[model samples]
Target: MNASPIFHRLALLAPLLCLGFVSISCTGYQLQTGRPQALTHVKKISVPLFENKTLVPRGEILATNSVVDAITNDGTYHIATLHEADAVLEGTMETITYSQVRSTRLDTLRSEEMENTVTLHWQLLDASTRKILSTGKATGSSRFAIDANQQTARQNALPDALQRAATQVVGRLTDDF
Candidate 1:
């Protein structure tokens, strides 16, 4: 019932709790493992036209749009069209592999499910420092079903697959950089 006990307990723990908070806040200053190296003057970013090394003709456009979207959406840096920006993101679509993974039957094995996998290799470079800030790969896969018509199903699945791949690639680039 005495106020003295409560005051004594608060005084005892106040310093320890303050120290813990201070340590937590200070930890943010340390560089994370894959974080981009610190820049001295660069504040803008330019993502060059991505090269689509894959046979798929649209791969380059999709990857480029994804990177630009991700970077602009984050609002962390200025997105630039000129190559003189602080950082540049470059990407290559290595492969786009498709396969029929499963066959389903509503009445008889007439419906089939197919999957498409897309793999991309990307790097973030610090333009000023000429250093590779981060390098990594990302992959995404999507599946769709075809009933009696293989071509139609494949056509329908392509957009979905490309979108998924682009999203994943963007996520990996941002998270790593």
Candidate 2:
């Protein structure tokens, strides 16, 4: 009878012991909510329309929109109008290039896969002083199959490239990477 009661007490306590161990194991984990030291003072930023130096039409709109969208999604900085912003992000779409990534086995001259790359030059400036705080170049690329409609395929991949470049720019600005 004594053994039976002891076993029952241990059985009831096992779950609590297990839970305690789990909680203790997680004590080292911590939530990260702080920004990088370099950008701690910047809270709101404004992105202007990117200048398109490339030959592609409307490339500026796409690049600018992509950066704005990325900044909005990062949640590190608030998007504000030029008048209300603490900083201004200016970008120029410098180049859009396409290269053959993979050639068809049957034809060396034919491209089976192609990569689209977008290069953007950006500057972060103080809103009040118009002084450049940071400047960098970000490049983004996307690979796509060269289907029968090569133009359509290239067009579809352009946005992805722009988005990647935008993300890199934002990461550099906020994460200091």
| Highest lDDT against the true fold, candidate | 2
Report the lDDT of model 1 for residue 159: 59
Kindly report which residue pairs in candidate 1 clash with one another: none
lDDT of each: 0.69, 0.91
How would you encode candidate 2's per-residue C-alpha lDDT over 108-159 as one tens digit per residue? 8999999999999999998999888788999999999998999889989999
Q: What's the lDDT of the predicted structure labeled candidate 1?
A: 0.69
**RMSD each, Å:** 4.9, 3.4
TM-score of 2: 0.80
Say what the RMSD of model 1 is.
Answer: 4.9
lDDT of 2 at 25: 93
Regions of candidate 1 where Cα sits further than 4 Å from its true position: 1-43, 105-111, 147-152
lDDT of 1 by residue, 1-177 (tens): 667987899999999999999999897596544323443344677888888887766668777776677666665556886666877778887887887677554544444677888777877788766698667787778788767777677656665666666566555554532
